[model samples]
Target: MAATLRDVTTYDLKLAAPLAAGFVLFFVTPLVILLALSFQTDPQGGHYGLTQYVNFLGDSFSLGVLGSTLWLGVKVTVLTLLLGYPVAWLHQRSPGWARGLIMLLVLLPLLTSVVVRTFAWVVILGRQGIVNATLSWIGLIDTPLKLLYTEGGVVVALAQVQMPLMVLPIITALSRIDPNFADASSVLGAGHWRTFRKVILPLSLPGIVAGCLLTYAAAITAFITQSLIGGGQMLFMPMYIYQQASTLQNWPFAAAISIVFLVSVLVVVSIFNALGRLSRGYANA
Candidate 1:
């Protein structure tokens, strides 16, 4: 028994050593490098200050990037919820092949590459694209409406891309809810709207919270979709960071920008998680 226990311990240590090393190499080492570079000066390679951070905060360009990214994230989250709830509910209530079809449609984007998906949006939203041409033919406008290169374009693209993330969680949550609760509410003379507002929404808050967090996080860092659809005019933080690190060759400033974005994303997500928990508690009570 002692020898068996010793062998198990030895094997565990042997497995953990490589994993620990890989963790350091893959995650920790890069984070440490970013932290170090975030403080270190560039060109002069002098001792560091908060100059990069201050510059990022003070620069109107960088500030605009942050604002746009956050605003787009909010828009995407809200729009996704509006569209996703119905789809999720349908999926939950669906029978037989209908449920399978709905789920397949919801998850179709997951199998496709981001670049390919964005390109497809580009075609659909282009001036001579299907949407514009259809609208023009229907006498909506004499000209092809400018869909690309605007915030609206970015939101539309993002919502489509992130819809699956929203739908899946909400459906899962909705599925766990007992249909008999709605039946009971009806038996008690509650209408559909009241039952949904009081019962269904409360129970599904967890899934809503999870989906919103996932959508918001993805939107905040969205790059290719924003770039292709926004025509480089949308300048979100990720794009700004990309330019600073790759184009400008300012590693320290890039690192600082990355850290700032990381903190901002974490703060927003924490707030969302907290609200979700509080709402869930209130619902239970």
Candidate 2:
């Protein structure tokens, strides 16, 4: 006799217990300890107060570092979206064989270490690098431009490094869109730009939001790329926290800074979540 069956994974809460326990033990427990430590006035960990937090928030330099890091994320996210959208759209529009080649190129960056990728940017942006050489060949300037160790350099490098994060989601979203919708818009006498602005863009809002969130988070916290491209002079939150914890040995202040950064990131994530909800409605309309 044949037996009837159904998917058990959908309803099996018990299957997730071990994962939940692991998360609690590894993540939640450490986060709680860190939060508690952030309240301590002493690095030694017993004297509890808001001194560390007050020091951070009340200081202008510290606030500037936080603001600059967030701004850096925004710049990187915007550049990535602008560059990635075209690549994704191209991938979507390409023929079957071309799609495979485009996808390979997109996935190629992920195969290597981030450090390696970042160092490649370092070479490319250096005084005698390809950019300067190209500019010289074109007579754009008599001298090599200072590209490395600048904010612009950091933004460009981060965008290249984090591009796939922005592109892949957009490709997925674009693929889901019905081709007939575009054709219908054209039939309704909408020009290409009008169809894209009205139909394609609205439908792709969810993917754009997802891509932006991922790119923003990665770009801001990219310690390796930031350190290599931005140099010691450009101080962001990751470097600030590292200096406090490792160099100065001020664990309490580091913990406090970390908590504040975490809260700020959570706020950004909440905004993205709200955008995602709005995008769904916008897409429907």
Candidate 3:
């Protein structure tokens, strides 16, 4: 028995070693480099202190950019949740062939390169795009409305891109819920709406939280969609970091901005996790 237990422990360690090494090499090492660089001086040879962070925090323009980035993340997350929940619920209750079709539609965007997807949106939302042509033909306006290079355009593109990530998790949670619960509630004289609100929603909180966390994190870190859709007008944190790092060649300041953005994402994730816990506790109570 002792020999068998020792062998099991050795097997577990062997299985874990490669993953641990990869995590340290790929994720932890880059993060450590970024943190160290954040504390260093920029290319102009200022003293190595908190000068980068101080300058970033003190600048009103930087503050506005941060606010816009964060607000965009929130808007994208909320929009995805609102649209994704019903789609996921319907997919969960769908027949086998219908389920396959829905899943295919959801995952189709993921199969394409992000650059390609953003370009497609550019074509569809551009001034001479299908939408504008249709509106003009129907006499909605004398001229095309400006859709590209705007916040609304960015939000629309991102929500469509990230909707699958939101939907899959909700579908998973809904699938795990037994249909008998709803039936039992109906037999107990509860209406469908009440049963859904009191029973289905509480049970699905875990998936909602998981989906929101993923969607919000992705939206915050997004660059391609924001750049393409907003056409350099929307200055999100990732875009700002890219400009600082690549265009200005200020690696240290860029690193500082990245660290701040990382902290903000972590804080948002923590809040979502806390809300999930509270929801579960209330449901169980």
| Top-lDDT structure, candidate number | 2
RMSD of each: 3.6, 2.3, 2.2
Better of 1 and 2 by TM-score: 2
- Scored by TM-score, the top model is 2
Query: What lDDT tens digits, residue by residue, belong to model 1 across residues 148-225?
Result: 888898899999998998999999989988899999999999999999998899999989999999999997788888
Model 3 stretches with alpha carbons more than 4 Å out: 1-11, 44-46
Clashes of each: 0, 0, 0
lDDT of 2 by residue, 1-285 (tens): 578687775787897999999999999999999998899998887789999999999999999999999999999999999999999999999999999999999999999999999999999999999999999999998999999999999999999999999999999999999999999999999999999999999999999999999999999999999999999999999999999999999999999999999999999999999999999999988
TM-score, one value per model: 0.91, 0.96, 0.93
Candidate 2: misplaced stretches above 4 Å?
1-10
lDDT of 3 by residue, 68-115 (tens): 898999999999999999999889889999999999999999999888
Candidate with the larger TM-score of 1 and 3: 3
TM match of model 1 to true structure: 0.91
